[model samples]
Target: MDRIVRGLALSTITSSVVMAGGYKIPEQSLNSMALSAAYVAHTSGADTAYFNPANMAFMHGGKRYVEGGITLAHLPSNEFQSLPAYSGESEVEDIPIPFLHYVSEAMGDFRWGVSLVVPGGLTKRWTTPVQKAIAEEFTLKVIELNPSISYKVSDHFSVGGGVRLIYSEGVVKSNSADAYNQQLALADIARDMEGDTFELGYNLALAYKPTSDINLAVTYRSNIDLDEEGTATLYGGGDQLYHDDASVSVPLPAALNLAVSKTWNDTFTLEFNYERTFWSAYKALDFEYTGTGIVLTPFDDPIAKDWKDTNTFRVGATIEMANKITAMMGFAIDETPVPEETIGFELPDSDAKVFSMGFRYQQSEDLSWGAAFLYDSKESRSIKGMGTFHEGGAFLTTVGVAYEY
Candidate 1:
């Protein structure tokens, strides 16, 4: 029971290679995806509400800004090669994510904005006998709503903060009724679990413009714990063994970002960003079960997760061309928090290089439309005694419309 529960808990929290360092999805808007999440300091649209609310204080007064978009994500299957019987490939996944943001007209020196976005999620399924025994199916979905306010302190400085309302749902399933388990003299063990939770946090931002051509910004998002409570059904020897209530807790680690941008001749802009993720908050996976006379073995002990913090660097270039067109390109280097000693099937993550490009066209005086594409290339990782994982990566395409009135 303990072993199955541990696998379920991990798969439910972190398993998708399409996400960022952990299970976080950082590209929630057209500009964000086009710039590999490097649009923090030089935001020019309603998305400022989500990336850096402080920028709203500096926006053009007497106008309302609105932006909405959707992203299509395609994740390729991960190939594991080693011993023939131990080798398998994870199933391919395709997902659609949507985002919306709005900024209100200024009221004196104050401004307000709101955003609806998907912050993090995951989905992984393995059908091979060996892999299925650990993670047959694991899925997680998350959503967030943020409302923020900003104050213009001076000509060059502004401050803002927001409340984070989050909701999440998860499903986990595993089975071990196979010839390999029979060879090991083990019983036909299996488990099914479902859970959901709602949590709260906060975010803060600061923006400064010392000169007309330069911009600087900083942002922070607080951590929130997801306490998932649900029911679990266990099986042994193809027979129902136990049915009981279960619960587990995991952290949606905090993050901090520092960004700077410089514009040349008011036609070209370049931006650089640094991001820090505090994944160290996740130390262990402990599941509690409530059932009388239920033997707790292997499943009762807490599993160690000793994950470390990670850093990401990004750079972007934007060119304002003639004919009401804007072109953007970006690159990024991302590091994984999962250490080799603790890496497993649930989350086999690695360092990656990201590339992105996009263009926006101004169709009318008050309407604009754009499209963006991003590619995440992951490096192959080798485990000491297990196997090597290769050919893992993700592709994303985003389309959006913006209106100002």
Candidate 2:
């Protein structure tokens, strides 16, 4: 499988406010955050399980490394005020996102690893009358469990693959009267839905090392169609459609990454990475409902997304500081997938540039700890067809500990 995930960028809300181009969060670990998600080629820690499992084959023999961490995120306020009395900012709180990973040393040229991570998600809410009609609230929570194994074909080549299981939960709210431009106004109608689903996918990776200082890696994460079904409650407007069936099918796009890294002497290492996300798979958002006559009419229409694929470029550096401590910094430029015609309040996204920094401390022969921070600077966008507003940046901080033997 070959794919690069799409963006989940909405105005930052909650503690885990991770904003990228669209909705994909590649920074799942401390090192990944520090490196602006460009650590694939030079991966050496437990995060290798999620970043580049193939690199596990080059780890020290007969050793096990486990690491765990949590990241804190903040998305500032945003405002979108257009005609027709539609305007409002967001009220988002801080959130903590936790992750874990483990990688085992090579055994007969075979190595294995596992990871529990959050690939991407979204959270947003609005209070404005006009904005509330089409998009009052939209939130998504996801967790992924991946287990992988790698084989060393030679001293210079290794290949790896993993199974991906994702659990997704979501809440969506909107006003039917507003959604139809006041065409169906029985009492300012609104629809609410809460549901959860599970999906399956896979990923593949290849790692190549030329000599001891240079490494190259390429990885692909497959796409998953999120199939969700839950209860629907239609309140107000003489249309009492409550506790009914509701469902929708959305996509988690695939991602492909290519990276190259090398160390100069013993002091510094640098890496560059390029990512391609297949957002074209997302063409529309169509809701399905099974309810009484005329009950399902308003919410069953298809909303076109017309999203396009995107490209991301990342570069990072590591400095071997004194006392078993190391410093890292990175930068990245990411693109958005949403077309201007489809941009709206429900999922306002844009291109972005990010910067990051972090450090790690080795406490002993068997224990180590790390911390990192990243900031996202979103670009301002204006769409004539879709009246939306996004005015904010995002902040992320992470701390982790590792044990090795």
Candidate 3:
């Protein structure tokens, strides 16, 4: 019956990369593609509301706009060599994200907005009988509620601030290995995670325009300590098959980004971005005990990633054509966050490069539509653990739409 506890556990396939690898940052890469030169230009969609809320202040005709949309991501699974004899078919089934935003214009030279989005999270399945021997599957979910305000000091200089409200939920499982470990049958593990929990956190950002044709933007997102509280359901006949209350705290790391946009002429524009993720903070996963003498302890070891700060570089360009049509293209390089020592069935990550393209069409003076495509090819990484070592790489494809009212 520990099926419920197994269901509650979360599984990570390759190392966790919020945007570069795992779940792509649901933001539109095309919005940045079209207006690389405009100080207040952005993709005009629900996603823009999450990336740069201040951009809303400059809405055309000093009017407010509301929009919503979703992004779908696919990553095929592969055989993995490591501890727990898990199957190689573990991969992301499908990732769907939806969001909404509200922007207010010219608040006395200041702009304000609010955004509700799913920034980063995942659900992975390890179907191999061997892999399931260690643990069957894992799931994680996150929701962010952000409110922001910004001020324009001049046409070239601007600043902004905001607060983030985040809710996170996680579930994990494996064979009973310790006195603290929760025992469960593979079938029962899947039902426990059917439950979820929530928590809160905060963050801030800044942007600057240095010249008439170039603009730079930077942002910082803070870490969150997500605690899960829920009941574990039992599937089979057993005295201690399920628990009424169980809890755990997962550490979500923080990050920083620096980006620039340049205009060469009325027809072409370019953009570049550098991002850093502070992953060292993710040292371990803590589980809470309900009984005194001792209940069950699973993975209570010191888990540390020789993880170094990761870096990401990107370059994008846009071409403007007749009758209000625009095209987009871009490329990027991303570093892996997992250290070989800490890499496991949860996340097998490596360095990678990305290629993307998109387009926009004007439907009328007040309406428009946009679409984009992105592909990521990663370098194969060799990992040694759990008595064996194997090498593999990952590929990701993302497509999304945008609407500006």
Candidate 4:
């Protein structure tokens, strides 16, 4: 019984929320989405504050920059095929995410900026009997507030750092009583859990321009542990088993980005970015319960995650065209951190390829607007026990406006 409860609890949280490369959403702005999150090196406009704050020092010195946008995300269902009794598909999901960024005018070689963004999250649901027993519904949401400062150290070098304030919420639900459970002779079991947390971290950035048309940048974000405390209700055989205080901790892993860009004739620019995510920080999932008279055996034990670090490569092209229009296109190759041994219904993640494109039309010297579209295509994955997962991906559309004053 304890082991069953433990396994159920672990799966509930593990399968909750994930998007790009282990639940990290790197595209937070119009330019970022248009370029498939490859805008780090040659960042411009207000978004520079979020992508590479060090670039803030290089913006036009006398004008304030502001940018705001929203993204509409559509996540298609994931299809699982295996034994006839275990085959199932997840529900499709649609969500709206908004973001804002601002950069103040330089105050003698020092500049300040701020950003509000949804850095990561996603929701997955399974209605089939077997799948629902482990992951009926799992959702995770995250918001981040970042304020940063940049210093122009020389004619060609700048440095920046920021404070990361993040808030996260999680929901997990599961149930048993289906044919599969009955076949195993397991008693009826169910669980419902909700929790939230606020955490802190930091980010650092460096930008260097060795020539008029070349830009190089590097950025690092520290990891944060979200310790969520809330209540959990467990049921067994149609009877309430335990209801009390419950807690769990998950890591918002650290990441490092290195990028470079080159411009030709001041009209065409190309950039490449390499990202490394330290998902190894996510070592385990352990839940705590404070319910009197409840036997906590395997329920209190730690479940190993053993996720590995991953690498992603991205390339983008931006063209300054006629009619004050700027066009951009990007492609990325993303790797999954979840190993086959640990993969499950909640997070059937796999390697992916991303493609994106967009255009911005300058309305005037001070205002510009545009839209971007991105598509993530996941490769089919074969899990030892779960069989094969296929037909899963995400589509995003973004509209944004930027202004200078």
Q: Pick the candidate with the highest lDDT.
A: 4
Cα deviation at 235, candidate 2, in Å, is: 3.7
Q: Tens digits of per-residue lDDT for model 3 on 213-317? A: 666777667767666676444222223444556555555667676777777776777777777777666565444445333232222223344556777777777
Global lDDT scores for all candidate models: 0.82, 0.78, 0.53, 0.85
Per-residue lDDT over 1-405 for candidate 1, one digit per residue giving the tens place of the 0 to 100 score: 233334433332232212234546899899999999998999999999999999999999799999999998887888878766667899998989999999999999999999999988877788876567666777777899999999999989999999999887777777766623534214356667777889999999999999999999999999888887887676656777667887777788899999999999999999999999998887877767787435234345666777889999999999999889999999999998888766766567788899999988999989999999999998999877667988767898999999999
**Candidates arranged by TM-score, highest first:** 4, 1, 2, 3
TM-scores of the models, in the given order? 0.93, 0.90, 0.78, 0.95
Q: Clashes in model 1: which pairs?
A: 2-299
Q: Report the error of model 2 at residue 46, Å.
A: 0.6
Candidate 4 regions with alpha-carbon error over 4 angstroms: 1-20, 179-187, 293-299
Which residue runs does candidate 2 get wrong by more than 4 Å? 1-21, 176-187, 236-238, 385-388
lDDT measured at residue 291 in model 2 versus the true structure, 0 to 100 = 63
User: Clash number for model 1?
Assistant: 1
Local error of candidate 4 at residue 110 (angstroms): 0.5
lDDT of 4 by residue, 1-405 (tens): 233333444453334433334446799999999999999999999999999999999999999999999999999999998777667899999999999999999999999999999998878899987678777888888899999999999989999999999999888787766733645224456678888999999999999999999999999999888888888887666677778888888888899999999999999999999999988887777778876635234335566778899999999999999879999999999999998866767778899999999999999999999999999999999876457999888999999999999
Residue 281 CA error for candidate 1 (Å)? 0.4
Better of 1 and 3 by TM-score: 1
Q: Residue 339 CA error for candidate 1 (Å)?
A: 0.8
